[model samples]
Target: MDRVEKQAALFNLPETIVPHSVLALGYPAEENKEPRESRYEENRVHFEKW
Candidate 1:
């Protein structure tokens, strides 16, 4: 909190608007590679009925 506050204060930015909660961040790691699946083909809904 202290570090973030100090940095925000230096920039003269509002504490309320300062992004304190990081949504997502991480180092790159090996992931299982796979072909992309089709969404429209599987979950198709007609205009008046499925």
Candidate 2:
């Protein structure tokens, strides 16, 4: 077992793990500055007939 697993066993906690690739591919670390309303408006497409 690794250090993390060893620590979890010591503290009686489950070993929750995330892959490094996932961490790299996830959202940016910086805070999102764009307003939600504007973003939704910009991305939305109105369907004339559905």
lDDT of 2 by residue, 1-50 (tens): 46656545554553464222211234678989984553446344333311
- Per-residue lDDT of 23 in model 2: 17
Residue pairs with backbone overlap in model 2: none
TM-score of structure candidate 1: 0.32
RMSD, each candidate, Å?
A: 14.2, 14.9
Candidate 2: 10-residue stretch with minimal lDDT: 17-26
Question: Highest lDDT among the candidates is held by which one?
Answer: 1
lDDT digits (tens) for residues 1-50 of candidate 1: 78778656655665465635423545458775785575556454333322
Which of the numbered candidates is closest to the native, going by highest TM-score?
Answer: 1
Backbone collision tally, model 2: 0
- Clash counts per candidate, in order, are 0, 0
